[model samples]
Target: MTSPTTPGVPPPVVDLDLGGRTALVTGAASGIGRACALRLAAAGAKVRAVDRDADGLETLAALGTEAGGAVEPQVLDLTDLDAAEAAAAGADILVNNAGLQLVRPIEAFPPDVFHTVLTVMLEAPFRLIRGALPHMYAQGWGRIVNISSVHGLRASAFKSAYVAAKHGLEGLSKTAALEGAPHGVTSVCVNPGYVRTPLVERQIADQAAAHSLPEDQVLADVLLKDSAVKRLVEPEEVAEAVLYLCTPQAAFITGTSIALDGGWTAH
Candidate 1:
């Protein structure tokens, strides 16, 4: 394992500063998106918190203000592709975190749900990235962080739409990284395994039904079964990784994924 401390350097510190930066975070009403918005704001960035949940955005903005961070709430449904693109313009940091999930086998999945999932998860990110790139290229500095999941890397039964969208996001992130590098922008994905968030909580019943297990057994028998950690990853943990990817120290680390999977992928 790599040593915790670098030779001749003090232990790492959380002193990242983004004083003059502006960040746009999608799905900022809750879960990983909410955490990322707060984390970026805490680092001194003016965060534009975008979501369809107006009340949740208001709550998040108030919490961010209490933490001495600037959080501007923007109510948006990502299905409006043009608006999603427009919302990303002029952002120094763009976090593509908005997503929806539907658990069903490919054959049984509704076409409409699959299309909606793809539009929100995959297409919105592309539009946001498209809108953010010009400013980034002109300024020659930017960060694009896609909040992907372990589903982006590994497939699970009964999650066809989610898995397909995530896999597409992984590819899109890489392409952005390659195209952004010369202009001093970095694009990367932060993949966490089954984060302890409202989204995951909502999926428990569906997972149980799919696996024919009890709802109480879903967490241990289905969700965490492949995870060596035996617990759901926290949204804050994933947020921390997203924050790190935006720092100067991580400038050269792009076109790759930082997995906070707790050894789920090891097997």
Candidate 2:
């Protein structure tokens, strides 16, 4: 037989089959969330793509259709806690990825923005997990993947809200893992350093202003300063980690975080 591996092409990280699984991915309109949604769909899971961006959801749905994957777009703003919880019901796999950020000094940070950030990033996840747990417990098989960040493990200046929320998420994830273990469900966090996404792109301006540097210099002197890899993580890489967690081989891997931080945490 010819070589099983195609030259210059890497094989899939995991040979996972989720044929009858129903996966719910928040922020599915873009970036890591979108990558996870599509990856799950490609693996035969029926993906419910949730995002507030109707146009983006449409685009994702179209792309999913073209790839012959089942992706149903759910236009939702995760801030609406009731609806967010309701939308999560019956999901076998839940990826809590929707988030917003504001880079500012603690004293200068707007209280309203702080509240909004926690509401969307932290509270919404609590509700979503609450809704998903019943079905997961009943089925005795479920995956709860929380998209956290390196900030969850380490603190950085001018990212008060994001860091605080991520820290809280890590604790929440561990708690869920403890509770869900008896039910055969797993909860884990995937922490990436700084992924190239619209969220990071938007932060460049604020980061520049905060550090008194040119926008171009923010990536080198600021964002990647502590990263040994000296480059941004890709959304697909993070998505792959999330996918691996949902596999049977990862059944015992719970209550912890997979850090894709480019050695940021090693410091």
Candidate 3:
């Protein structure tokens, strides 16, 4: 079955060419990260797919090969800030897509989990950008796409850590844009609401339990409560936004977020 196009926003027709460019995508083993890696590779970029899940990375590599795209799998944990930074060196495009989520009230949230979320979601992106800027500055061009979320713009109960990290990411993305603009680099956030990813899938039961509802009800009433469209955003759709941001036509766009929230933020 085909998915419906976002209303009013026509499907993108821009032709992207990333020939001779190297793109580094964190958490490329699955979901939005996997989609973005494949999309960029199909556009002729040499993609470095990073993730701690070696098995998942293998699957992504095979998928890329089947699609006739160059995907080099790098098994690394994003929590290793230094390694994450080093992996981004020489990248023409950097997609900071690695993330984790925990749905718990601030009082109930584990401190370690919160720390892990911040380290991976916020600090690592900072380090990765710091590493990529030198090469990007030298070439006078680069694209940095941070996979933020609607949580960055609005708060939801029982998602303190994820919301906090995403909010911090928004600021970090803007800061990168400010610093990167002079070097011809653009930094932007792709804010998706409840993507159809493993992360969200795992949250279904957690959200159900947290909200005292069934899983299905959690999806329809809790997750989609604020979204007028009443559907989870697809990973490929988010990848397309990332692709669009990397195109020459998007050179003038920076320091802002492109919300793929199915009108969740429109509320």
Candidate 4:
């Protein structure tokens, strides 16, 4: 008899074919969004990479060119809710990944910043989903992946705006899943812990200041303190999870969150 494959020795590899599909990814100019945009395009989908950073988008498009993937950069700020909705029109796969963060105690948090976070992370996704659903329902297939955070499931201090926005996104994702089930559409959330993104890099300073810690101590002491894995998750790793959700194998895996938090929530 052949020996059984060792558990977790070599991770399972997924092969997906998304030929002729169109995917829209927000915040596609950098970090997790950029990774997802390229990953989807590599699977033969036409990826509409949306971001406010024109230069970053150009770089992303160029990277796609090197990968022999299709990436169409769309420069638009998600704060413009109407524009966000319009951009999602005719998308077969929608990845709502655009977000901003402000690290301050609830009392010290700027009301305007909180409002902006809600607009970009929650309302914009609602509008985009609303815009994408009609075409998806007509075609009988769709995927909506929200790039949430471990914060969505749990809470942390000094991150009022981000935590609230992510929690709202979780509810929205689940509701979309229920409504879209019969229409052959699926909505899911990919919740990651501290990712090795520019956003997190910038946060180190803010977090250090907020927690009264040295910059170097922020990662291990603050970010990864509750995580079983003592490392930041790579953007490519999160992108892989996003790609898997778009695969046919994940058709039934809707209305749920796939946590890529390295056992952060296990605690």
Better of 1 and 2 by lDDT: 2
Residue-by-residue lDDT tens digits, candidate 3, 1-267: 333365533345665988899999998999999999999999999999999999999999999999999999999998989998899999999999999989898899999999999999999999999999999999999999999999989999998888999999999999999999999999999999999999999999899889899897888889998998988899999999999899876888999998999898887
Q: Which ten residues in a row have the lowest lDDT in candidate 2?
A: 1-10
lDDT of 1 by residue, 179-227 (tens): 9999999999999999988999989988988888899999998999999
Better of 1 and 4 by lDDT: 4
TM-score per candidate, chains pooled: 0.95, 0.94, 0.94, 0.95
Q: Point out where model 2 deviates above 4 Å.
A: 1-15
Better candidate number, 2 or 3, judged by lDDT: 2
Residue 210 in candidate 1, Cα distance off native in Å: 1.1
Model 2 backbone overlap count: 0
Where does the lowest 10-residue lDDT sum fall in candidate 3?
1-10
> Each prediction's Cα lDDT score?
0.93, 0.94, 0.93, 0.95
Instruction: List where candidate 3 sits over 4 angstroms from the true fold.
Output: 1-13
lDDT of 2 by residue, 1-267 (tens): 435486633354555988999999999999999999999999899999999999999999998999889999999998899999999999999999999999999999999999999999999999999999999999899999999999989999998999999999999999999999999899999999999999999999989999999999999999999999999999999988998899876888999999999999998
- Across residues 22-102, which tens digit of lDDT does each residue of candidate 4 receive? 999999999999999999999999999999999999999999999999999999999999999999999999999999888
lDDT, residue 175, candidate 1 = 100
